[model samples]
Target: MKVQVNSIRAGNVIEYNGKLWVASKVQHISPGKGGAFVAIEAKALREGNKLQERFRSGETIERVHIDERECTYLFKDENGFTFMDKETFEQLVVGADVLDEDQSRWLQDGMEVTVSLYEGTPVGAELPKTVVLAVTEADAVVKGQTASSSYKPAIVEGGIRVMVPPHIGVGTRLVINTEEGTYMERAKD
Candidate 1:
């Protein structure tokens, strides 16, 4: 289906130049001297080559139609990441090539995710916007570094590093933004 350039998002597959490409990143830029445009970083699905393209906000692009299945993350093994269909209860093994390391790290056992399948093959997965994780490691607060803008580097449940507030410490449960891999706020529970 053809959609406006602004509608494109990361993890969307599109047909460009007669080739299938998966968007890795999308950014909207409105410069002072030029019209607003959407910048896309995409990777070729078959050739594995990456290309960056910019499209005017008014332009439309072809977005590939894919089947979105609600699946629950089971585990990761030598084969790859495994997920079970929530409805059918059938399992599907998605290769590492489909989901990057960072995206895979956010997966928790039994977490519901939307797996995008093209022609019955897994192409990508979408994770929740936020997740709750416990801080496993954190740097010691520096003297006189208690400024409101100061942030400390910390490690979360999946060994992912994130910049957290100075008050956050080991064992602190934090709400993390999965998409950007950043600390959002302290978890209520």
Candidate 2:
């Protein structure tokens, strides 16, 4: 699919210079003297290479279409992460290079994830926008820190740290934005 360069966002797969790349970062700049352009930092899908490119607002870019399937997390072992297709009951083992550290940290047993397939091969895994995790450790509120709204650092189940409100404490289940690793609110349930 062809899309305006400025419309591209992070995590979008695009084809540039006859190579498949995933946009890791996209920034739109409009200088006072120069025209508007979209700056993109993309990583190669097949090979682990990074590339930066700029495109004018009027320019179009090719967006690669990927097949997404809902798969249930099975386990992770010497063979890498294993996921089972819910509908077909097929098992897929994806490598660590494709899953990455950040994505793998949040993989909980029995969790469902969206696997992106490019030409029938697994390329990436997408986690839920928001995940509920319990706060494993929370810093104690300081004496004067409670005067205004402030955030404190805390650790979650995945060993990832997140800044949560001061009122939150250990054992509290908090709603978090997985992409940004920020606390949203206390889990209702």
Provide C-alpha RMSD values for all models, in order: 1.3, 1.8
Candidate 1 lDDT over 61-115, as tens digits, reads 9999989999999999998899999999989999898888879989999899999
Any runs in candidate 1 off by more than 4 Å, and if so which? none
Compute each candidate's TM-score over C-alphas.
0.95, 0.90
Clashes of each: 0, 0
TM-score of candidate 1 to 2 decimals: 0.95
Q: State the TM-score for model 2.
A: 0.90
By TM-score, who's the top model here?
A: 1
1-189 per-residue lDDT for model 2 (tens digits): 998887888777899999999787799999999799999998899997999998888899999999888999999998789999988999988888778887788889988998888898787888888889998999997878888888889999988899988888999999888777788889999
Best by lDDT: 1
Error of 1 at 75 (Å): 1.1
